[model samples]
Target: MCQPPAVALSLTVSVLAESESASAALVVPHSPVGHHTDLDALRAWAQHCDVVTFDHEHVPQEVLAALAADGVELHPSPDALVYAQDKLAMRERLTALGLPCPRWTRARTAEEVEAFAAEVGWPLVVKAPRGGYDGKGVQVCREPAEVEPWLSGVGEGGLADGLLLEEAVDFTRELSIMVGRSPSGQAAAWPVVETVQEGGINTEVLAPAPGLDPDLATSLTEGALRIAGELGVTGVMAVEVFEVTRVGPDGGTRAAYLVNELAMRPHNSGHWTIDGSVTSQFEQHLRAVLDLPLGDPSARDAWTASANVLGGDYAELYGTYKHLMARDPGLKIHLYGKGVRPGRKLGHVTVYGGRSGDLHSLEALRERARHAADYLQGVVTE
Candidate 1:
């Protein structure tokens, strides 16, 4: 829920739903994260604003605290948001709550990392406890030497929460569930979606994860809702989970899931909900943030696949869409209206309601979404 370019669409959708003109103010941080945030200007702005919500998690907690002290209402208060802002806090809290998570520990020195690596075995994940997203502050270290550079930078104010080391999970697939909870305690969940990741960025999403076990799906959805309520999270939160396989003592493998991460705002995984669900995540977020009753997050399509359209060589996206619209009229395209930079997330496309069932029909939907995404990026000419 950080400052992704796609947040423009979420804001637009929310504004349109409320039939109100929303003002978007950009706060250019003087430095990356923390005190660099222009608190004085923000405080002045918040004085006139009714409710201040965030699109990204980079806002410093102190800033939020200062605003709250001034009585500026903020959704997903700093108390609940600390979990999303700091991986260490999230891991500690989730684990303490008996929620399933990868076995992890905080490391301030290379020795600590190596010690943990010995227990977890080689190939562990090292992450920045704060200010990390899209795999930027994360690293996979197979051995102690691989963690040297990052560890050297730890301690002091460099790595605010030090370094986080965890066992690199052997997951079957990535799954994400989106849920919205209001201050009134009303909560709703959408179908669990399988996420396709490329370069650590979510590349595509399959709504109602194809071939997902009903029991497993129910468990994930329920677990996500439980997380929101337990964490005191209001507004839409996407719980990213890792679906893993467990073998009982009888040598029978069983499917299970574990919490991997949490986003306290609309996430890329829920982009498909815009066109495929009864109520989109954007609108749901606004409702929850405003303390309104939650929306029904039911899917309107049997098979919906959302493909992220990355910035590519081509720039004439508007012209290319002419051919795309004529080709697949059902394709739902959402562009961020930002200048294209190679490999940057420009926007996403969603295709739903082909009446496709399970894996059989989902492939076509996936391909259609993929092709449209590629075409818009000028990766596919025909």
Candidate 2:
């Protein structure tokens, strides 16, 4: 069985005893990625490795550029990774590329924000250009006064580089497509999946997006591949898109999609591929970054559903797993070994094996996955 190279593991390991084995090595770090001081240790660490890749996009572009200049192999070069790191940059680049995207502009003052909102209509979305994820550093402003806090913070140097304002898209559902690309130019894409969000955090995902239009699905998949190639990305990339449905003159609904955001790593949206697809995203990412031949991304089951286990009222998550496993032996539960905190992602549960065309069967699969996830998170019992 092929496995990821042990040299590229994340630096932060709480369980040192278990992680420090004869086959793997560990490195102590400075600040988190993006800080000037963080690069000092990373430079030293990269000197000994053949190639370096990232699990997240927080590393400062200057640091990545410096590493590349020093002859270190950094997959998905800094130029490509910037789109994932900065929201404003991403919107500008994607728009310039002629990709479908929401109307947006950078707002440095209350006047600029109000002007954009007036032109596009409220409620507008305000987002920090950098260092925001999982619904953090983002807000929906229904009126100009609602944006005063962000506007005031910009003047005080609290909001870095101002904020990004976008016309809140009117969409029917959220979708995501995962694609893997190699330095050698080979690329592969997984089936698009429907993403369910609650309180701005993704709570569940249904693979292949039940009832998705065949033509729309093909277009989105191709769009994901095109974006990866155009950006010169050399790793797995997840493209978050919004599907908009409109009533046609004939009274039938027609759907189109817009590019929402990008994530150049193994994203939560693809976690279902772990047990539901022929090749998991984790393995595909490792292969892409290493420039190895890519793996097949075909689905292993007719349908698959993955539900995230967010930290909830229950702190003793492990205690509930026995009941969950016994209730559904087919459910695959994954825990990250982290302390519980409300709304934090603790882990996820994936359930597969159902006929895709059967709505009842699909709902059953989703319920099974959600039930196990909820039980572990202490959301339900019996």
What lDDT would each prediction earn against the true structure?
A: 0.81, 0.82
Q: Model 1: how far is 332 from its true place, Å?
A: 0.7
Candidate closest to the true structure, highest lDDT: 2
- Model 2 misplacement above 4 A: 1-37, 155-159, 247-252
Query: Would you list the clashing residue pairs of candidate 2?
Result: none
* Candidate 1: stretches off by over 4 Å: 1-36, 156-158
* Candidate 2 lDDT tens digits, 187-207: 999999999999899999999
Residue 36 error, candidate 2, Å: 8.7
lDDT of 2: 0.82
How many residue pairs clash in all the candidates, one count each? 1, 0
lDDT of 2 at 78: 92
lDDT of 1 at 229: 93
Residue-level lDDT of model 1, residues 44-132, one tens digit each, is 56665566677778778898899899998888889889999988999998998888898899998877887888888889998888888
Each prediction's TM-score versus the true structure: 0.90, 0.90
